[model samples]
Target: MGGVIGLDVGGANTKAVWRNGGERRAVSRPFEVWRDREALAAVLREVVAGVAPEPVEAVALTTTAELSDAFRTKREGVGFVLDAAEAALGGPPLFAFTTAGEVVPFAEVRARAPEVAAANWLASALAVAAVHPDALMIDVGSTTADVVPIAAGRVAATGRTDLDRLLAGELVYTGALRTNLAAIAPRVPVRDSSCPVASELFAISADVQLILGHLAPGAYTCATPDGRPATVEFARERVARLVCADAEQMAAEEIDAIAAFLHAEQVRQVEAAVRRVSGRFEVAPPVVPLGAGAFLAREAAEQLGRAVAELPW
Candidate 1:
């Protein structure tokens, strides 16, 4: 059952996908690199070990974890990630996927760490573009959203780095889960009146999604903002706290309304990013939604009158 393994080491989570013939298995581990940067190697070993039916042929790695604040510089972070992978999977051949679509061997990654840094979107876009020549791919993950455009069988991205991508509308900081509620909907409607939200991490987008039924309890994989259980009722309580209220003080329906509004705001964020990125193309292409916030991407694509290409990745 050994074929290949693909791993994404993100700022908030580490995900691995093992593809061997017809069997595909995935493993996801919540790992806040900023909390304990050195522990990443252990996490890498754990996730791969959990998902591997047997030792895979080779390991392909992409990273946005390099953008985490744990390291003083991106170079350090990239080197650290490479080091972790080397330490964890010394037996497996390690390769790094770059923004330019180069499969760099681990020996070369350190010399070209800058290009290997935060190139997860390109890795995904290139994989999708292999099938769909011209399309707009929206990947709304837990902490960020990527709007990648592929044209004529080439990766047609306007920006290569995170900073440049943000400016080019290829990256939207708002995501489905981990994002703070205060960053998006600064104000909320309550009791037929508008209320200013507390500029705090009282709630996150995951709570809104849970209450809005966009995500189920099991799908809320990360830890809650308040460290409470991930349940619809608890999500409602978290959403209520955004407006300086609680479950007992606010009606459940009102909380639901708040969740709906927050959900719309997040959808609006991705939609706006998609619009901006699509403007770079001569003719806007259809959409391909990916990641945890795919529902939000689909909503945005529908609003833009673009047909979604349902591809099994």
Candidate 2:
């Protein structure tokens, strides 16, 4: 038996796992977007060295970044990924994943509909089924949480990936890294009266992750809309600062209030998701949670009155 490689290219970081004779061996450094193509390729080469010096027979790539219109306009982002893939595998069969559950050939991905659910949370959920077989996998990654139902080792697909799908409980958009608290809750208790949240910061569901401990400092990717690293303290400061735009700012009470508000809203969303799948699967489907934001996922499951079987990383 030869070796194989699995590469998950995300918006914030790139992860690679090398497997020799079906046994996992080594991994790579979390490649930040600040690094150039040459640097990323070097990192990949380093990760795959001991397992396979040259290209393997196949390379399965699940890219959440390259498919976004945000990345398409940049031009260099997807191209750089292709460059890295070719450099590593000598261009062997490259499979691009999508929320639709179809493994698209590289040529099709490079030419059309890249902006669709290419490597959406649904795709990650599918990846989980290959191992768990009959468990519901909830992947709460940097930007979204995907709750997928798996039975008989196949991931169920909804054929939809729009924001409405997420709101309707067909998908879970609440993530660890990039969701606005305002979106989570419009009215938050500030002082004696409820104050409407002001939309200003690029803060995401990650704020909830930070408070919940699903994510740590280094786990979060840098790249604030202004293009800087986001420190935990920085996130806290910005969140705290948002409180000041109103009369509630004087007491320094709005920060905690907002955190509490966001946390509750996240719980609401998770409960709604479990309800959506309740008709099809068990009221308790042996939840298998994975991702950078597993801690929050666990809490979300509890909100639905279920227990989680968290995978060991």
Top candidate, metric lDDT: 1
- Pairs that collide in candidate 1 are none
Itemize residue pairs with steric clashes in candidate 2.
142-177, 176-206, 179-204, 179-205
Candidate 1 global CA lDDT score? 0.90
In the range 45-114, model 2's lDDT, one tens digit per residue, is 5655645566666666765555344444423566666567657655558766655667766667665444
Model 1: per-residue Cα lDDT over 1-313, one tens digit each? 6789999999999999998877788898889999998899999999999889577799999998988899888899999999999999988799999988899899977899999988999988987898899999899999789999999989889899899999999999988889999998778889899889999899999999988788989999999998999999998888888888999999999999888888888888888998888887789888989999989999999887889996775
- Worst 10 contiguous positions by lDDT, candidate 1: 304-313
Q: After superposition, how far is residue 282 of candidate 1 from its true place, in Å?
A: 2.9
Whole-model lDDT values for every prediction: 0.90, 0.62
Q: TM-score for each prediction?
A: 0.96, 0.75
- Model 2 CA RMSD to the hidden true structure, in angstroms: 4.5
Global Cα RMSD, each model: 1.4, 4.5
